[model samples]
Target: MFYLTSGVLFLLVALSAPAYAEQNLLEGGLLLTAAALSVMALALILTLRSLARRNAKLSRQKQSFQRLLAETPGIIAILDKNLLLINASSSLKSLVTEQDHSTLAIPVPLFADANGSIDLLPEIRQQLKQQGIWHGEVWLKNEHHCEAFKISVHNLSSHQGKTSTYILFGQNITKFRQLAAHQQQQQLRDDTTLLPNQLLFIEQVRQAIASCDEHYPSAALLILDFVVASQSEREVRLNEQQILDIATNLKLLVPETLLLARFQHNIFSILVPPHLCKQYNTIFLNQLAHKLIAGFNQVDSQGMRSPLRIYIGISISPNDGDNVDLLLNSALKAANRASEQSDSALCFADSANQQQAPDFLAMEAELYRSAAHGEFDLYFQPKFSISSNRIVGFEALLRWPSPKRGMLPPPTFMPLVEETGLIINLDRLVFRKACQQVSYWQQTGLMRGRLALNISIQHFTQRDFLRYLQDTLTEFELAASLFELELPESIFNHPTIWLRERLHSLERLGFKLILDNFGDGISSITQLRLFPLHGVKLAPALVKYIEQQEQQRNICATLIRLIGYMELDVTATNIETEMQAYLLHVMGCDCQQGHRFSRAVPAEDIGQLLLKENQLLNNQRQLAN
Candidate 1:
């Protein structure tokens, strides 16, 4: 009877919805007795309660599963055979919130290999199919940026049920990678300056040498050592801060193409690429070293100052030596020699050329003896007016005719003279000789233009330089206006109020000052802006390539125009070709000097050039008339 009641209840529930009955079933007496109806109703109530209990248990289980996924830091998902997301962890919502969780399809091409490969997902899936698992790293891009993840994939299938799926887990390792990079940087960088340490510096040199080619012929290494004076308590603290400040300044000053390192305390090294090494001469590098020294002695952020000195030693690859140890030793030796001189603090490593290398003691002795005996002769290089093609003046150059060696250029022996502190004596002799020669020329009616003289900064910085200039001019009975003092732009590297006052004193004495090699130093325009000057001489190499390069021509033209507007005289040197001369003339350059007019001649030969220039002026005047 119980089974019959349960079956009757089941049939009624199933067929009642489609039954087209006019009367109510409970009211009808033909199909049921009172007891049978009661049994069917009881069975229906029991079935409904069981269904509600099962649903409640399933809802609670789902909530617990979601809570676990939400707390997890990584991503977990199940995918079908077509790589459609069957279910995803709550953590994935942070990356793609608007994605349809019920059916999310990600193509294989969407995943990029973290190792910079083009495709990774297709191969990973194939490996999973064969090996039942795959593990690797990949990159995923969302709306903002890409992130790296370590991914693990597992293949799952049931023998009884033919359903198959993949289990995927992803762990974010971006911070771990960054920590590794930070540790590596700490190992390779200096603690104080944050520049590359000595070991890394040597490694860079080795790599540069290994990569050298015909097109890239050489690389240069410059090691700078500083001489710091005794400092007070406040200055000592500032000194520590200065290291970091100077490092930051140098990084900004040097181009990205070069490598700068802090080899040791107060000693920095720079690696010059082949192109720059070939382009810049030793003199320019010396100017760079001086600029850095000036920077070193500057007041720190706390306004505390210290006395500092810098010397630089240079070595070039395939010339000084190709090996790292040899280069380091050679540069350090040169630096040691440089630290003893005032005229210059830059030295090149000794080369293998025996003819050029002389014993230091013997050379110093010879230089001192030669200075005492006045063995130096002056050579003159004539300057000419650009538009008129007339000789304007001559620059007196010093030449040493050594008795032991044939005529030696300044580069061959100036450092030795400077080291012996005999350069000041040499300068005095040159000054007196130049004044006497100019006086003689004027007396003989051989020359009429001003005479230009070259004076080293070491000599010019003397305490009584002004008094010596006055005395020299009086002794020769020559007026100050007839002489133009040619000072290199490098003099302005050490900016000081005292230096400015000295320059003003010279100008007050009626001497015409000319800034020589105007564009060679780091502070060319800044020098011009800071001080009063009579004239500017453009760098010779810069003028040489003006016509060949349009960019160079434009730069020259712009500079010339700006200087002309300042009402200052402009002179361009190394005008070798007629095209260069014509271009300068068109650009309104005031004067020029080059082989086009004449090479540097002797004092006696100057009369001939003056005579020729006078005749040319006469011809032009006659033609104009």
Candidate 2:
């Protein structure tokens, strides 16, 4: 209104003033001077009036803007194109508790931490100057605080001649970020039987592989599925949800450090650190394969086959693919190869994998047929007491008697057995064979040592497998103390409760339990507290160094002392040379087992060797004499 009145008065005065007369000099001068004075008064009044009106508008807008800024959700602020908060709302104001400001605006970096990397102000300024917009996410940190935020700011010009900045807006977005983190956490399968979503599992694999460069890493993706997995048998209901649940349960059953993801309905991706692989065991990977099948067969209480009983396939990083997509694809196809015909897991390693699926399928069919026809046979190797040079036990080793391929080691058909799900029966057959041999020896007084049977990580059923084992022992009439079981380091992969119960039962039945290839498999040793054990097998790696290297000797010596202190027996495996045996004797490994004595042989040969024990253990007689 003031500006309007001033503008009207200026217009009236300009109209009323007469034009300067051209002919009369005095009159012309007088008229021009009057017009100039009126014009000057009008201009001054208009300037003052315009200033007053602008002030009134500012006062109103300022109150409303303040209200809006204060009430808005999250932290909102007006920043200079430099990200220096020219004005801030109450939320941003509260976050800036340390700084004393009459008004609520400040620099965003004030909230950031020392040592935190920030590409904030310059980037914001550049975006604002060139595009007039800035938008993205940023992480801000302080000694006491750190936060993730989403921000957006726009460039604006002020009316003042000075390049004045407009304070824009901001919202904290902290809750949204936390929600995202929570969602990411759900990828992990918990003991509560919660299945990790597919997205979460992939992230875990990527994270595991990412650390491969700096730390221990190797992955064996085992895809368990039906050997003859057709669409379905007419009576067999394909409950996808239940199958997924079973898989999730299996994942939860393993150790926390392991990453378990459902690669597909009948496939699982297990990212195992190379050392954790039981392949390095003295018993080797084939024996490990047998053990896994035995354990997996117990997944159900009734006789129902578990959905988790799928084929096993593995693909390593860089060798399979550097990234997840290519690696998973290759692994899954290998799993398919194992599934379609039944060969445990095939690594995407060689030209043979590139061979058509049909060839592998036919190959799987033959392997299963061979197993069913009793193609595998058992061989026994002796374990001697390092101090006594007395035979204390024998490990039952497996052989594949192939008609076409001749006598093949367990490694030859073991992968195929795991793939075909025939290992469960194979374990049973091997155990029975070993039991019969031990029983035969005990009856004839030809064997002095116990028979050691290797156990699988998966063999502990919630139901009583120990009872069935006892029945077998009774059937064979073998003394309880004469049977021992060997377990690989992967036993830690099982649930604590199940393992504890099974071990207790075995102990109660008087069977000794020993760990095979101890130091070789663990990054950090699995706590012995979780297990009931009689002895441990020092891996060949430890024994190899015990001879020539003082450092290795020290390590072996320390390990022996540690094992002795706990009152647990120690056996050094692969005692290939007399020097290794001497070291074992000096270091106090309770037993020594390897080729230095004899190659693993048939049960009859073992009986003959036992008959000549006095010849083999002359050192003991000398010590006694």
Candidate 3:
């Protein structure tokens, strides 16, 4: 405004004094030039002030960009067009040496070749030029250790569309690689003993077989099955401490170079390379087997040797059919055969033994067909009251009189039946049959007592067992009081709540529940009292030598007394001798059933026995009169 005001006043003075201007034109021109110079000076000052403000703003932005580059956790760098390092983030410094910080071009270690022969920089540059970007993993080695980085590089273009510089970004992936490797290793190892699991073991076996040749003709696979023996008929399981001790002992006996793995519960496998058995394969394996057996004979707290048995089975490659599955199956079959024999604890795979092996598939199929067609019969064994010498009840026994294999007993096929999960079906059949027989006997007006049927634990614990029992009895038009369910002592092994509820349900239905084979398993008095049991049958083993062995007699007497005190009826089974029955009767057990009275017979024979007992009672009454 000052310059403009001065210009306007000067113009007005010059216009008003034209005659004076003509007289002093040189002086007026110099005055006009001075005014123009002043205006130009003021414009120069305003432009300088605006430039100063813009420079200050640019400086603040430059500082912020520098701060972000310095503090960034990821690696960042800027390289000139010639690939010389212009700037880099602070995180990049840790991955490089001091010399790398001072150097202009990218560090040599970033593109180091694994074989120290190839250079990767040319390839990277080519990719960046063609695609405008490059990405891959790179390994960098410092003084302390090596590190892995996943890096990406891009071409920074100028305003004229030409490549100006290169921008690089990287992430450290060393820890991630390590964690993935650790997880893979864990997946291939057993959690309990930290040994290679079955999956890894099979891989090793396959590798061994693939590497075999004529020079190395045979490799050995040994399957060691460990068993703990107890006097009781129930299964004995090894505790954690016992398992650890066995593993430790086996490790000491075997060489560390061989692979040892836990194959299954109570089973261990050892892989012996062909080189170890090149000269004396049999001698070496036999020695190893003996050593394993001796190691297991550890002394217990009572200073007595432990009852641990080790069965070793050996199968050689190429001779035992070659592949992983074939070798494993052959070894298992050998181990099973070793277990069956009493004299030998070790066996080799052979064709004869393999032929003798039971075909479980065929047996399982036969069981399914038998259950579907109702091709089974029940035999009744009369239980007599020792005091009155009269028939009280009959225990129903399952018998399969096959046309191909006649007179097959329960022990012959029941185990397979249970294993194939067909026991439930068979039990249901027996129950329905028992109900029908009792109903018929009642309709004919024959004197029939409570009929006992052995019920499987799996069958009895079924959710619909009670309902089925009620429905079946209702169909037969019979009362539940005519039936008795004999359960094994193993029934107590189930959840207490479930077992109690099932037993209570049966009791509520007016049926009697008897614990069979009471003294043969891990049964306690507490279990006996916990459930609603009407009686318990003594195991046949306990009554086998009660007449000859005084110790056996005393044990039975004590058990009978204990059961009698609990207000539960005691029945003795397997009484084959007259002396056995007399002794049991003297011990206060009034009910007995065994071959001494009669072997299991058909329903018609049972009717005759009942009639004979009634006639004897009548004659005795007449004699007393």
TM-score to native of every candidate shown = 0.48, 0.50, 0.50
C-alpha RMSD of each candidate structure in angstroms: 15.1, 15.1, 20.4
Residue 469, model 3: lDDT of 94
Model 1: residues with Cα > 4 Å off, grouped in runs: 1-351, 359-363, 415-421, 618-625
- Count residue pairs with overlapping backbones in model 2: 17
1 or 2, greater by TM-score: 2
Query: Using TM-score as the measure, which candidate wins?
Result: 2
Off-target runs (Cα >4 Å) in candidate 2 are: 1-360, 461-464, 523-526, 615-625
Error of 2 at 545 (Å): 2.6
* lDDT by residue for model 2 (76-144), tens: 676654466667777666555566453644566532323567547677666666667667766555545
Write the residue-wise lDDT of candidate 3 on 1-625 in tens digits: 5555665666667667767575475466567667778878878998998888888988989787678767787778787765557777766755554544533455535654333345556777777777778889876565654767788888878442276688888887878888987898788876666777788888888888888887677778889998887867334897777777778887888879889987887888999886665533554565566567667767888899777878878888888858999999989888888888742277779654334233434555677888899888999998999887878888999988665677788987787677557899999999988887787778776645799999998897788889999999989888888888899887877899988988898899999999999888888777889899999999999999887899999998999999988999889888899999999999999999999988898877766777787898899999999
Identify the leading candidate in terms of lDDT. Answer: 3
Backbone clashes per model, in order?
0, 17, 0
List per-prediction Cα lDDT, in the order shown.
Answer: 0.75, 0.65, 0.79
Indicate the worst ten consecutive residues by lDDT in candidate 1: 351-360
Better of 1 and 3 by lDDT: 3
